[model samples]
Target: MQWFLLGVALLISGYFIYGKIIERIFGTRPERQTPAFTNNDGVDYVPMSTRKVYLVQLLNIAGLGPIFGPILGALYGPTALLWIVFGSIFAGAVHDYFSGMLSVRAGGASVPTVVGRELGTAAKHFMNSFAVLLLLLVGVVFTLGPAKLLGNLSGTSVPVWVAVIFGYYLIATLVPIDKIIGRLYPLFGALLVFMSVGLLIGLAVSDKSFYAAGITLENLHPQDLPLWPLLFITIACGALSGFHATQSPLMARCMENESNGRFVFYGAMIGEGVIALIWATLGMSFYDSPEALNATLAQGGPAAVVNDVATSLLGGIGGILAILGVVVLPITSGDTSFRAARLILSDFLKFDQKPITKRLMIALPLFAVGFAISLMDFNVIWRYFGWANQMTAVIMLWAAAAWLKRHGKFHWVCTVPATFMTGVVNAYLFSAEIGFGLPLSVAGPIGLASSSVMLVWLLMRGRREQDDLDTPAIAAEQA
Candidate 1:
């Protein structure tokens, strides 16, 4: 019954957040042709039908972040899933949809471009540089973390070094933004569906105890930290992700119908939120002890737990299928990451315009960096990735708020979610001070610093615009 409720919530949230709100705002732009300013020959400039756009966006945006965010959220309990689902629909979807539409309408520019236009050239470059660094961190954490986990699940005995090398090569060969994603994305989607269905069936047949693994209301932790900050961490996907803002604009360029932004942006986000909910639920069901969870995560790794859960539910065949699904999960995510890295480099550095050899030269080094990170400690990397992801979302939320105010519809929209997230993120950073609570690691501080800078910039920009409006107009009578 809870699962059914979750499914319904997922659908409703997707419609409201993405379908209604996003479509209403940017949907009108589809009828218009690509703006003259954005004339580029790369995949970043290619136009496609709304359906295909949605599919690609869905796969690309729904990366490993969703998979792990919920697992961490589940540490708080099953109810954490509630926050993730709701936040994804109401907050995450809205930010993604509008950010994409805004970028498209503005000549297929990225978030950094939007920032530059609204703020200043200096701000644009600053944000772009920050985004590049953030993406590199994300590539390392998100791509490599999953690769290591998948390796554990497969038992292929491919050492971390080999797995990382193979993964990088596979991505370079199969997921190049220019030629591969269009051909391979659908195949990846098919693999995901097969694995998801197989795992679901296995769980259903062998595990009659649905809620046994869940943390009940009575088990809620009695920490002194405020609810809002914890919620910020638990429902981290939508409110403010650095990663989403980067990818959203990239997807915007390919949108067939500008009006479809809501569906593609919001719908895809809801899909990711649903993915997170499933994984978190599974984690809770399979591991009851925090120590045990950590130990298992340490020894067998998180991917191993995914296999254990599937095996517990489905026996030997199910375990094998589950392993296959786990393996594909990271690969799909890595493919998306690979594409995102390409887009970041191509757009910011104009690398896409370079000769193929030069482009390859740029891509190879990035692949190597990611591979090296994968061979190291993925858990530490994931923590920083989460922080960077949320920080990006924070900037987008502020931008969305500005957009709403500019359009004169601020009163009707649910800006509270955005506001709440901003405050919570700030508080999370503050908690680290005075040494009274949990300190988010170095990566957390980096994410917090970036978000703080962006927020201050946005606020000042808003005030300046308002001040200009307040000034009286010069009269022609003096002439």
Candidate 2:
């Protein structure tokens, strides 16, 4: 319980303290016109209040990752709390803030273009392909998962639910930003908040049975998965996700002021960390023991836990609301994942989005591909999505580090986390049976050594390219 409370407090306090530090480090320029105004095409770049942008950005990046991710991470123990709190403030929020602000300064450039500008075109091209694939994979998985749930609720067939959901994605992807996303997101955001807050209240007042499973130094994960890299990767979106970097550019094109980047980007990430912490605490403390929770998980899955909590703790009207929250969170994220993919591709092709025909030209083929993937076994897609999500973050973090270095700001703010995640991704890819068949002992050292080498290389490059602190670093690295 103490760990849970402290984690909650840390996430809230982080927004006020660390958020401002990041804002200053990025040197926000309110006097400068943001892309929302300068590039207000009304298709993807339309100015909006900081609050709306914050909410949409929140739903865009979060999906089921923060909610389910933390619950799954909790299976590892309270050490997951450490990753959620520290990683959110130090790594996640900071990454989002810088990446969003970088896009704003670049006239709403997509993340790949930002990477190209800061890191190099080769890095940019790699990210372009990697990000689009990740987005499509996430979009399809989120779509299929939610549609299946909605099917259960509505008594509709899975294929029918899928077609309906894909119809929405098609429209949402093709329409202007304000048409569907800007209007409905506030309601979805409110439902999300209400569900989380209700569970929090339940946790506070419920029997000690709920809080009995508080974590200790001992490993409690049923599978005995090593905590080092697995825990970090498990809790990506709420902590440090590259997926957030992709969504940042969406809000970057909609921000009203450069100074608003802190609130929209950094603040939204901290908000997600709080949601993740809530789910983690509930997942951990609700069970009588780690073994019990694992037993339940084995029988069902993460959604089973959501069903248990919604029906058991928050009964009555709150229960209905809780169930709906679980149902819609993925839908909200899926729509925007497709939307973000469209924007990324548009930027990549240098295609104007002013024509609805042009938007569909790209969106149709993309959706066709995603729809085909939806036909395969979803678990396979989800397993790869998790790894790809973190790998994307690693690339964006390196881009942020390069941006900071050229501008003479504190590059370590991003570089350190980037290096850390570099190790995390490599370790997972090398050690996990789902990935490579290497032993953890061997893969762990190799991952860290590789990351250390890259860190040193980045530091050396930064030293060579030092520039005046008074001006922003806008130079593109050589291809």
Candidate 3:
């Protein structure tokens, strides 16, 4: 059942990502450009071919967000995989594809720029500031936590601080998107594929017996947590995430083929969702007791879980392979985050295009802040990221709906995605209140606040359209 579901996810992701969504949204010929910004340069503003842009966007958005997020979701068992697989295809992919195309139509503007035009400059600044804060939180907690887990698994003498510093340095050196996609991405992808295959092989060979000791679904409930909130957390990546909006715009700035936006943005999202499904299955297949899994994770961290699973299947080498996989996954995400931070800073600060060195200046501080945060409490930062991510998605979905209405195609293209996003977000908000028992956490409040703002904006905008229609009819009759 798990493998079948995973295959379904991969197929859907492949189709949408390959071209289906883009063809529907863009329809070949280019749209009109706003008179606000006209200058274009080859270096930062060069037009790219669809294939190159698709690959670059894939790498950019396919980072650690999907991997770590899914692993966390897997704690709930196999049902989580079901949500991720379906949600990625319907909700997450749609959000990313539309957000990227909308930005492209607006002359390669980032999310903040698009929001600023529609919701006022103050809203744009708020959104950017919120995005920066979310990124910083992600860098410190989720991004760096994966590295620390890797260090523990590898049994390397390297201290956590040293590992983190080296990680940041590696990211700083690869700030240029071209160098990252051209050189580092392939290497990272190869390592991930190798490790994943090895782990699977080891699992097949393990003598412990799959259903005997490793695969029992006993004692699945550890905290007596309700099913719904657990499901929300489990199915997190497929629903709304603020991080995706931020990521979509970064890819939008360099899109080669406006028509390939669906493949790059939606495809990458589905890829992440598929990865999550695999990890969730692993969680179910490997551990019998949720308490044991939690205890193992707490004692040895996530790497310990991977190592134990690998060792059970492939022996000692499994531990080594697990460490390698964990370490490389974070590097991929860190590189993506570093580039994202640089782009966000450049766009927000209006830095000079010359002397690309200036962009590094901005990135340096952001990296330092991320590094410092990583050294502190990581769990808090991660929870905050979850909330902030959902908030960003809510705002973007509302915007996409509005854009679709303006184009007279809201019924077919925009309505469904927007409705799914709004429903999931609202579900999560309620989950936070009744399920997680965190009535006042930032995640719940931000989601509520954003949803309220979006509802008002959609309603008022609709009313204004009606008023305009009535005015035109009145004028015609009088004439």
> Comparing 1 and 3 by TM-score, which wins?
1
Which RMSD values do the candidates have, in order? 6.7, 2.6, 6.9
**Model 2 alpha-carbon miss at residue 115, Å:** 0.8
lDDT of each: 0.59, 0.83, 0.58
Q: Using alpha carbons, what is the TM-score of model 3? A: 0.79
Backbone clash numbers for all candidates listed:
12, 2, 3
lDDT of 2 by residue, 335-371 (tens): 8888889888887787778999889899999999999
Candidate 1 residue runs with Cα over 4 Å from true position: 1-4, 13-18, 35-42, 157-178, 206-231, 234-240, 287-295, 351-354, 371-376, 411-414, 432-479
- Per-residue lDDT of model 3, residues 42-122, tens digit only: 334545555665555555554455556655555655555556765676667777877777666666666776666556668
Model 3: lDDT of residue 461: 64
Largest TM-score belongs to which candidate? 2
Assess the local accuracy of residue 452 in candidate 2 as a C-alpha lDDT between 0 and 100.
Answer: 97
As for model 1, its CA RMSD to the true structure in angstroms is 6.7
1 against 2, candidate with superior TM-score: 2
